[model samples]
Target: MSAMAAPREHDGADEHLMELPSMRNPDPPPPPLPAAPPRRGLNFHPAVYVGFWITLSSATILFNKWILSTCEFAFPIFLTTWHLVFATAATQLLARTTDLLDGRHRVKMTGRIYLRAIMPIGLFFSLSLICSNKAYIYLSVAFIQMLKATTPVAVLVASWALSLSTPSLRTLGNVALIVVGVIIASWGEIALDATGVIYQVLGICFEATRLVMVQRLLSANEYKMDPLVSLYYFAPVCALINGAFFLVLEAGQISWVNDVMGKVGLPMLTLNACVAFALNVSVVFLIGRTSSLVLTLCGVLKDILLVVLSILIWQTEVTLLQFIGYSIALAGLVWYKLGPEKVLEHLVLLKQAAMEGRALGVVAVGVVTVLLVGVVWYAFSGPEGGGV
Candidate 1:
């Protein structure tokens, strides 16, 4: 009787222990999250930078065209001078008046550096601006943009020639596609002006040379500058050069009769300058945060939009061949951005598959190839298989 009683007592104690709230299952507390890093300046969504750059660039181009062509301003030199002058004044105001741009780089502002290095670059810059603006007078914005699509070719060639970048056949081949596309576009142009084409080509060359020189000079000096600092340094020199050209070449051409400001009034001109400087700031911000590849893709997208916008706003007539060629050039730009090694690997696999047994890669490649070809055909030829 005693042993049975003891066993019952032990069982009752165990049941009581289980009934206590402390003995029940409970959820574990959540792990703590790490703190976020602080942003340096005004916080913005990443798209802000890209959006501003694209819109500003497009606006500047359109504004310049309207001033020089439609308004019959016919003063490319003076207009360029105004842009540089405004940029210089605005940059100085931001740097000195406001504390916006760090504004405290310690570059050696020697006369030698200014005359030998900066002056030459500014000369090329001035010429490039003048020529591109002049081209706007003769060629439709759509056509001019189509020609500018070959900028990558000029950049790659110049970079390789200057030893700023390594040479690669794959790179060359990719850019060759771009050149081929531009050729096609040129062939199909409705209003091909000799002077316009010459101006465009000269502008491209000058622009490419300026880029290479910048890389070489700045890198050799171990000096890296944000776009603002660059503008601060170069704008004055560019302004002086452009101003001289204006006095020499354009003073007599302007009527000075239309309130001395043409159709785009003084207020509008000031707004344009503000937008242009904002674009410069946007470019600096973007390049600081993103990769070169991202910038290239953004540029390609901007070009495409500019072409379409030209058609919509200016009623620029785009031929089927021009559209097809622009598409091909854009495709090549995409390929170039994919990296040369990866593109070659795919191509080699394609060839090997053709020579040997078909593989999964071949099927994938064939599918993409077919898809691209079909799209091109459908775009160039009408829905009913007739040429446009």
Candidate 2:
């Protein structure tokens, strides 16, 4: 009995010793994770990106207008096809030669996805380009820009239709102001072409639909792509569709080639294509660097500048009523984008500034009031008040 008790005590001691080892020597904590490497490449200023995008975008539009209208190469379908073709080739080349389109590798793109997703979007994109180019042939650049001010309204409506966004009455009301302004501008057009207005309106609708579809695609993480990668997928399909249309509609007009080459020159056409492609690339940089608000403001500024340039370059006739309407449209656009809360916040700040007796704030309020009064007076005055 004494020997048995001694062995049991020894066994207990051995169990205690086993517990000690684990307590004293738990597995070592995981090695510190390797520090992430610093990002490489030149960091450009946001202004640089914004300016580059604006320059390319404005240049592309002006160049296309010059080609289709001034040069009298009136085959919009053919010109649009050429642009898509060049874009397709350029994007493919960039993908092979550089890492700019590396983001595409992450996209879980399959044949089914391309057919169902990309193809439909491409169809609308092609239509929008074709219609917009055709409008330039009939409408002045200033009027087209005025009409385009309603694009956000169209996009918002499309978003609601697609169920991407809930229909808010407040938002709807804000956008309605844009429509009203555009209607007034259209009424004031000195050389309003019904055909051109139809084409531009159709273009806006198609573009809005495309934008909504793109928003849906981008909602999925697997479908996320930068603008360049998006172009790489979209350009090819759009090019093919536009090519089909060109063959059906414009191919019979064989005389266009001689006119285009002789008047515009092959070199100028090539440069136009290059500028259009560059605009896509610039969009990538601009989006990466800037916020949506910046893009919206920049676009508004570009349109205004384009209107002024049209007046100077093509002697485009813009009546006083058109200017008033366009200004209203721009104001509505800003208000919509900024939201009522933001606008109120700014107003509050302005009030504070006025209370503080800031000269700039006082001047701004006075100027705005004077302008509003003047616009009201002129609008009611007579036909002469609204004349060019």
Residues 1-388, candidate 1, lDDT per residue (tens digit)? 0001111111000110000000000001011111112247856765676677667767777777777777776777777787789888888888987644453354556788778888998898888888888888898888888887676677667777776667777567767887888898888887789999999889878776776666556543334444566778788999999899888898877766573465667777677567666766555455434444445555666676666566656656667788788778777765665566655775786688877867765665675567546444543453344233
Which portions of model 1 show Cα errors greater than 4 Å? 1-41, 103-106, 160-168, 341-388
Off by over 4 Å in 2: 1-41, 346-388
**Candidate with maximal lDDT:** 2
- Per-prediction TM-score: 0.76, 0.80
Which residue pairs clash within candidate 1?
A: none
The worst-scoring run of ten residues by lDDT in candidate 1 lies at 16-25
Q: Write the per-residue lDDT of candidate 2 for residues 96-204, one digit (tens) a residue.
A: 9987788789889999999999999889888888888899999988788899878778777787777766777777888777888888888889989999999999988
Candidate 1 residue-pair clash tally:
0
Candidate 2 accuracy as lDDT: 0.69
lDDT of 2 at 345: 81
**Total clashing residue pairs per candidate?**
0, 0
